[model samples]
Target: MGSLSASYFERAQEVIPGGVNSPVRAFKSVGGSPLFIQSAKGAYLKDVDGKEYIDLIGSWGPMLFGQAHPSIENAVRDALSKGFSFGAPSYNEVLIAEKIVSMIPSIEKVRLVNSGTEATMAAIRLARAYTKRDKIIKFEGCYHGHGDSFLIAAGSGVATLGTPDSPGVTVSTAKDTLTAVYNDLSSLRNLFEANPTDISAVILEPVVGNMGLVIPEPGFIEGIQQLCKTYGSLLIFDEVMTGFRLSSSGYQGLTNIQPDLTTLGKIIGGGLPVGAYGGKAEIMNMIAPAGPVYQAGTLSGNPLATSAGLAMLNLISEHPEVYDALNQKGKALAEGIRQQLSELQIDGFVNQIGSMFTLFFTNKAVKNFSDAKTSDTAKFGIYFREMLNQGVYLPPSQFESWFLSAALDEAHIDHILKASRIALEKTLMA
Candidate 1:
């Protein structure tokens, strides 16, 4: 019955709460039994029942070269042969750190952590320590991990479930995190004026991918940078999803904005778990043995993760064509989806940047979190299920970006286009 999803979910419920490690993986939003993946290769994932679907999520955007990339797999294999973890400084960690610093234009010195959440968490602490300020500003719908500070009006899981503010997050923590609307410059200026010397940093997902791939309205990012400069507040770019995926230097390259600190993950790990925050040496010096603000992870730069990351980064560094290829593919996908939407006479918007995109079924201009929230999510759900039934796997939520990989070629795109037409048709009928 329906592959092993029903049975697997039933069994997993007893062991893993909600039948999955991550809430979204349980497919609670998608309204179907979760397909327990057996394995993945290139742009395709094989479920336990051996059904292959073209993967659009890309493991939430980590598989830049696509699943089971040979170079990364071989590097991980070599690393595994060397023994897993020493808990001390590993050469691969240093190598990966150096590689990241080389690729990212702003990150002069770096620190490694295990997840994007950890990287963002550490970046916030470092900003506080460096500035000696207690308050920070975070935009609505820009998620910088599940850290308590970023819970207010956050995106991704929070947006998907309609839980903007978490119960456990204290008002004191929320107070320190001044809320500003993404792409709106006045809200930020007002927050700075009201807070004065108490503000430490203004952190954001420069492109705001968490809120359904909303690109910064032109000059919005630069405006934020100007305000940060005038106020002497740190500008932290939470590039977890955008870094390496957008370009070699990530979103900063696309926008020509130099942030004081950048939190990175996803693609840098090469499909493994890894996170890093690096910026100017002066601010980075505020962290660890070099300074006072403490942040440490025993598995931060796990050998295998670093090796895989290094291999991936090295490939990107040498062959920038990967970004171009993915960009062209992304443009094709966006254009195809938009054409379908127009023909169906559906009110929708396709927000995109490079290989990351979202087809928000909405009449509103999704410039910020509020605008993104206006999307017709129910219609999206119908489209999602239809696409899934047609052998195309997508992020189960309207609020998450669809990441494209280099592995997606002519056949895959053609399949997705064909399936998408049916999906859109189903949505209209519903």
Candidate 2:
């Protein structure tokens, strides 16, 4: 019988460009037809062809309690009965905003948007207006969405597709958006010194997941904050992937380094399409209806999205222990992968944080985007396909992080480790 996923891809290619809406979904780097998911429950995903695999992407880091959670589904259903969107303010929006403000120290106010891209695009404009400066600094491989300013030296799909710079972004936009090396304080300092007072803000992923779960060095984040303070540049933390996944306050809570602005998405929407940008009221007041900087959307605070987000955040807020449980699972998975590499005598590098990780096909310690590029993409492709064959679904690209949900249990971890052992052994042979 012909594969259902392959058949669907064939038809999709006739209609959808590249047979995928997102570049990473095309599996260009992984070298295989991507699996079309039918449904998900807890820690497992059932493909269109009836193949079941333990899901490790967690919908790209929003399914904290796993797919189709009862409470979240119920919330969405209730919201559906009322309406999907009002195009006006709703109570749930106020509640979610209040919750976020209470949790995140830097954000005294927030405005909801449709996606991370919108939040970041709005944030850069706000930063420019507040600081009255044109240039902004972003770390290499730290993707702040597909904003024209961020397309230069972007990561995630852009990095996976081997095009660090995108075409649509004009030379003027690229010039204003300065790129610096991740985890390298010297590179950032050089930009500040070279640009002088032209820079408006320095934005980064406090715990970078775009470049395959690259962790900041001991004082890297602190140094960036200091540099921003020194240069009068606002520090903005793009916490779309790490926000609620790391802790209630996101990376800011972990490091206690307050940023001038924060951009959030993913978990905040409970896997729905939503994003938000907020910081001190003084700066946020500069946004439209209140201030001169104008930003608006038809579905800015969609009723269904707010309801789902509130449900998810409420669960996380009530069960603080979920973070501990997630970290434990991460440690177990990291150790298991390390053991497999040791037993199989394979050269690999594992970068892991609480519930987010990447197993790079390289022996070098990946501290930055340059180091992450040293990974053997060809070997990773083999390993990814082999793992899929072993009923373990991972991110299609080596440049992406694998997210673990609270839905994953010890049994799932054991199964993933067993699959890894087999996949690694097969990978070496291939």
> Pick by TM-score: which candidate is best?
2
Candidate 2 clashing pairs, residues 3+ apart or interchain: none
lDDT per model, in order? 0.89, 0.92
TM-score of each: 0.98, 0.99
lDDT of 1: 0.89
Report the C-alpha lDDT of model 2 over 1-430, residue by residue, as the tens digit. 8899999999999999999998899988989788899999988999999999999988899999998899999999999999877877899989999999998999999999999999999999999999999999999889888989999898999999899998888998888999999989999999999988999999899888888999999999999988998989999999999998988889888886999999999999998999999999999999998999999999988999999999999999898899989999999999999988988888899998898999999889999999989999999999999889989999999999999998898899999998898889888788
Please estimate how well model 2 matches the true structure, expressed as its whole-model Cα lDDT: 0.92
lDDT of 1 by residue, 249-354 (tens): 9989877788999999988889989999999999998887898889988888888888989999988987898888888898898999899988989999998778
TM-score of 2: 0.99
